[model samples]
Target: MSSSFQANLDEDYIPQNILLTGGAGFIGSHVAILLAKKYPHYNIVVYDKLDYCSCLDNLDEISRLKNFKFVKGDISSPDLVSYVMAEEHIDTIMHFAAQTHVDNSFGNSFNFTQSNIMGTHVLLEAAKCHRGMRRFIHVSTDEVYGEGETFETEAMNEEHVLEPTNPYAATKAGAEFLVKSYHRSFKLPCVITRGNNVYGPHQFPEKLIPKFTNQLLRGRPVTLHGDGSNTRNFLYVEDVARAFEVILHKAKPGMILNIGGANEVSNLEVAKKLITILGKEDQMDELISFVPDRKFNDLRYTINSGKLHQLGWKEEMSWEEGLKTTVEWFTKYSGRFGNIEDALVAHPRIGFAPGSSVSNEH
Candidate 1:
């Protein structure tokens, strides 16, 4: 066990039982594994609907741990959520489940609303009823802040206005409001963390880093939306997982913290770097092509993690090293790449179809 794991156990801060929604997915699975290994005395119960985006193989490493348990249930299912909360003696709720893809949200806003907004409502209600629960951590994305002319320089403080551009971001913003409402009205002890792009091992290949890396490895053309000049700060998955752990363990209640990487890079640059690292430079210029940009794609997304850093938490991974590790992981799991491409096709960029309004709440 790592020192962090031992410290969590020693501090007696381990919530006898933790309820992690979407625990079977990428980031959630990594977080669950860390929590389970560190505090073997605590029971960690994962509740997930196992949607098409989620793969059970992500949790294979932690499945055998005596401290880890999984419940196949959606957060939208009131009865199922309530039952699991009570049965698991869950005192800490880590809400990570949601429809996270922005492109998918373009044509299917309803599904995004259902899963991200309505689903979050279900979880908040259950937490309200679970009088035994102590902490509720709402994992959100920085997209809720919308795109700006320049990168967010001051680090998006909790007071940042909600300006979600895409359907996925809009629903996430709505969910964050609900969490705050619960904290204020229901007196729910909730903390929210808005993290930037997360990339690392076990990440579904549909994401840019994994998707492009897999394509390069397989000798396929890597598609770049727009001119691929959009800048985004990428946080390594393990760093993201650690950010949650730090926030849950040390941060104060009712605070929203921005967790981001130290470096920001453009999409085209990221693609070129990946190809270079893979020694596939010959295919770099030829394979990389800019497709039509997604509807309402943010131009630049950079977050300041000064607040998280002030709380003694800092991102430890560099973009270069992180990308290298991500490439290695995706190469090892190349078999799963086919499934990712199929998943990507399901959400074609229909680009602001009827009913998607430009003037709307974030």
Candidate 2:
């Protein structure tokens, strides 16, 4: 990139005050910390609804930062969103607020629709109207592409068909359409990012890595779905956060980027690896439980992230390093899940928490 071109990009991308929705959630919190520490000049307002899954503990690392402020508000409420944008003088919006659990979406889809679809609509409407709004980067998931049929040749690219099989994914797809529509009809400065499975510290306990780590810590059997042949690409949470920063600064309006991991492994392999990491390889036979498969489980998910790579973003953590760090966090901070008596209060489950009652689920 030339000096003149870089200057022009910087002119278009520099944000004064940024509204980071869902800053208390897993991925959001990680992104929030990165932004807060990396760019001290920018005011970072964390807007979160503080649902059961959204924990203030996630933001503890950056709570004392002078530029960081937490605002308790629902993104679904147009009035509240508008008020915050105007009051905070938000120039950039990184929207990560949504109900993101696939299993929960099956039972209580209304909450997902209200939070994911309706909430995005409300934010987009507000963004288009905000006179000072410079950019809106909508955070999304790779599940919206449904499933990958073949991992033999090519990976799913940005232009892949939007075929979400589950309710949660469906709502995200709907939200993405709303974003695209706003960019077309109103010419809102918008960018979209779809990330693969993200795992790291501060992730809710209900997710695969944390849940399994917690289960192993408690000497419980690891639950295996069906034959456990389902494969997924796992990216470290921090890498995904860095991708958001890259997209925010470098991506143009109407651009959709897919952020994925190079490390792909089967679900069964992940469980076995965790067992080995815990030094419980001998207990594999006794510590494994093969259960019925989830309804409409996708066999595999793979996405080509050449676009993001070409834009000068590379993952810093390897799979081994990321997983080891995650396991250590779960072992050290097991109390984040709360006690048995306060299980329901700690994690409000729609259908059920994956392994335990206290699910810091997404």
Candidate of highest lDDT: 2
Task: Evaluate model 2: give its TM-score.
Answer: 0.92
**lDDT, candidate 1, 24-122, per-residue tens:** 777888889888987798788988877665667888888999999988887888998898898888899988888776776777789778788888899
**lDDT of all the models against the reference?**
0.77, 0.80
Task: For residue 189, give model 2's deviation from the true position in Å.
Answer: 0.4
TM-score, one value per model: 0.90, 0.92
Give lDDT tens digits, candidate 2, residues 1-362: 00011223444477889999989888889988999999999999999887766678889999999999999888878899999999999999998888876766776788788888889999999998888888898888889988887668368888888999998899899999999889888988888888898888877765677777777888888777788898888989888889888887888777888898898889889999899999999999998788777677888888888888867789899988888999988788878646522221223345653210111113
Q: What is candidate 2's CA lDDT for residue 278?
A: 97
Off by over 4 Å in 1: 1-13, 151-154, 344-362
TM-score winner among the candidates? 2
